[model samples]
Target: MSHAFLKIYNNKRNKNFFYKKQIIYIKNIIQLLIIICIMHNFWMEWNNFKKNKNISISHIIINGKKHYSNDEYIKKTISKILTTNNFFKLNLTIIKQHIKLIPWIQKIKIHKYWPNILKIYLTEYEPYAKWNENSFINKNGDIFILPKIYLEKTVNLTFFGPLNSQLKILTMYHTMQNELKKYNFFIYSIRMSRRESWQLILTNTIELKIGTKDIKKRLNRFIKIYPILKKKNKKHIKYIDLRYTNGVAVG
Candidate 1:
């Protein structure tokens, strides 16, 4: 009976020791986990604070003319984006994206001015030329639909082509305009056909047809002979075809 009691006592003591060790290990692990989480959270908060230290925008300034762009429209767009924005503590990328959605904005630069002011520098799209009856194109050959306020504005140089052909046509138009400027004949519009043929209408309602091949050469030839044609014939000539290699045909 004494031996059995001793054996039972030893087994109970061993079990107690094993349970104590497990409990201590679990407690230590939980404490370590809590300390790690606290450190991580502290680091995250510190980083956030560093990135956005300055808060509160005192004044907002726009530095540019509002010619093609609507002032109220721009202000409304900014107000929508700046709900939680402070001058220096803003998500600049998001702000820029929102600003760019205003269409008329060609480019924009935004930054905080000292203590509590935000300044935005803007470059708006000027109406370089008209694309058609309703839209306008900038100097870079990008077409945009202008507001009704600017729809009736005077834009003499118009361009027409297939949807993706604006850039090419604009380039050719510029070149031809330079050649025609000496005679005081500014180009009113240029159209490129599907066959790559070019037709230009002058401001005085005269048309020039430059066929697909050797366009510049034929145009130069016609320009050379245009003075003689005007002096020889004062009659109304509708269109001048510069496709012939040796001579030009007039209608």
Candidate 2:
């Protein structure tokens, strides 16, 4: 009888232990559910706050060299974008795309200040020379075009060359100009033919026919002979042919 009683006590003890373990697991699950509900409520409240806050952009500051009268247009564009978008969700890439539509602007930087301010920085292309007939070349050899009004006001040496030769022509022009400047000579225009032959018109209206090969050597030859030619009444000299190996032909 004692053994049977002990067996019943062991069964009760095992059942009590199993029940305690199940209770602990259920309590943990309940706590996890409560924490998850609290997180969900907090997220919803934060989103609601963002939606209801007044984060509209009220001030826009443009900072850069205003080389052209395009500030009004830029301000108009920014104002149009603000009409449909909130400051907190402004798409800077979109703004940049719109701003780049202006032809003269070379580089741009956009910034956003806290709550209600937007800032823009701009850099305009500095026109270095006239390219072909309708475009301008910057000091960096980049080609761009401006309106007729702006172009009329610009006075620069014109460069003519085959298509896609802006950088080559600009580089050669600078090299030749530096060499010529040592002798007080100034170039008014430069032209490169489709055959790659180069030529220049001096500011004094004299033309230089520089053939394709050995161009710099030929230029040096001309520089060597220029003093003697100037002594013989420079007004009578129309053109100088620098294509020969041992001598130059004057026209």
Candidate 3:
């Protein structure tokens, strides 16, 4: 009976040892998996860092311009700037805002190419007309002042009033010019009335009072009578009133 008890105790001890060994092996495997995962993450992070560090600027491109600026000048100007972080993130809106903030740069687009290239495109404001010498207006009627360099050379039409007023007057003047081409009459200047009516100063020194509404009909009627008046050698007519529907009054 004593020998049998000793044999059973030994068998129980061996079983406990084997169970402990199994637990240790599993723990080791789990540790190894965690280490491998950490190493993989580190490797990925290192590769990304290297790629970012290798980024470079390949070409400095510029577009949408006239005789205003070139790529080399723009590149030089931008290179002098100390903001590289903003370039990498490459927010289009932010880039546009920054470019427009510059006096000569009206609108712009800055683009980034991965693995080290950047491109820049720009839209320069072409001043077409001058409004009272203080501000110059572009083709779209956007008002801006001229740079010191361009102030001397920009031959712009003389205009008056606020931006909205000037734009309206310009549009009307251009329309009238286009329509009156057949009559060989060109408008020198156009003034807007307080009630939004229009008064035109013709190239022949004739003043015309065009009412606020029905301008097309009024202009057509005036064109019909213009040749007759010119044939009668009437050069000093003060004002032609085309506001009336049935008749035109000329002074």
Candidate 4:
């Protein structure tokens, strides 16, 4: 073929290839726009479904052992949120935050039933003993505060200790109570001084002075001698000093 003919053929082929590429790009853009429109419509429908009044929560069932807190108080706490929000869109985190504001509530579990029911399972702290003046200690050694109205119903055993010593004091109280119970002696109060010294007041108002070191050993020794002391005018005993290395000193 002639050189001029070959150049013209090449130019025409290149233009056809460019046109095909542009067509493919335009098709891809159209497909992308179609996908975006479908997603936008789906999102709008989803939002409308969530906001529909038919799915709004109508019944809330609270199941738990109520001690200091009643169902009425809990219902009142989350009433505003429950009234305004849809069940499908209700946030469990928000509900948990509201319930936690009540001091008596220890742990909570929330579940949403299909359609319009919300169930909440609650666990309240069991007050095992009174701590210091204003707080109570649970069986798990956790300290919590309660309203003045509920304080009157608190356990008779009172524990006094420094800050951050709740677990230590609570554990000691349990150990001492177990040992004392064998002798029919019940502890009314326990106090831990700044120096870490321990003291106990029995139900009969008899005081026990337990020094800082070797507390368990000293207590064991005292327990061994308690029966003999009871035989000798126990009513006259005001305080028993168990800090000695050999025998206890009774006052």
The lDDT values for all models are: 0.80, 0.86, 0.71, 0.87
CA shift of 220, model 3, Å? 3.8
Candidate RMSDs in order: 12.0, 7.9, 9.3, 9.0
Against the true structure, what is each candidate's TM-score? 0.66, 0.72, 0.53, 0.70
* Per-residue lDDT of 23 in model 3: 100
- Pairs with steric clashes in candidate 2: none
Local accuracy of candidate 4 as per-residue lDDT tens digits, 1-251: 69999999999999999999999999999999999999999999888876774567778899988777788888899988887788766888999999999987899999998778889999999998899989998888888888798777768889899998988888888888888898788999999988889999999898999989898788788788877897986477898999888898998
Candidate 1 contains a number of clashing pairs equal to 0
Winner by lDDT: 4
lDDT of 4 at 186: 92
Better of 3 and 4 by lDDT: 4
Clashing pairs in 3: 56-116
| Candidate 1 per-residue C-alpha lDDT over 50-169 given as tens digits, one digit per residue, 9 for 90 to 100 | 776655665778888777666566667777556576665566677678888877778888887654677887888888888866788888888877677776665767888877888998
What local lDDT score does residue 135 receive in model 4, on the 0 to 100 scale?
90
List candidate 2 segments past 4 Å from native. Answer: 1-55, 234-236, 246-251
Which candidate model has the greater TM-score, 2 or 4?
Answer: 2
| Runs with alpha carbons beyond 4 Å of true place in candidate 3 | 1-59, 70-93, 102-107, 114-117, 126-141, 144-159, 203-207, 211-214, 228-251
What is the alpha-carbon lDDT for the whole of candidate 3?
Answer: 0.71
lDDT (Cα) of model 4: 0.87
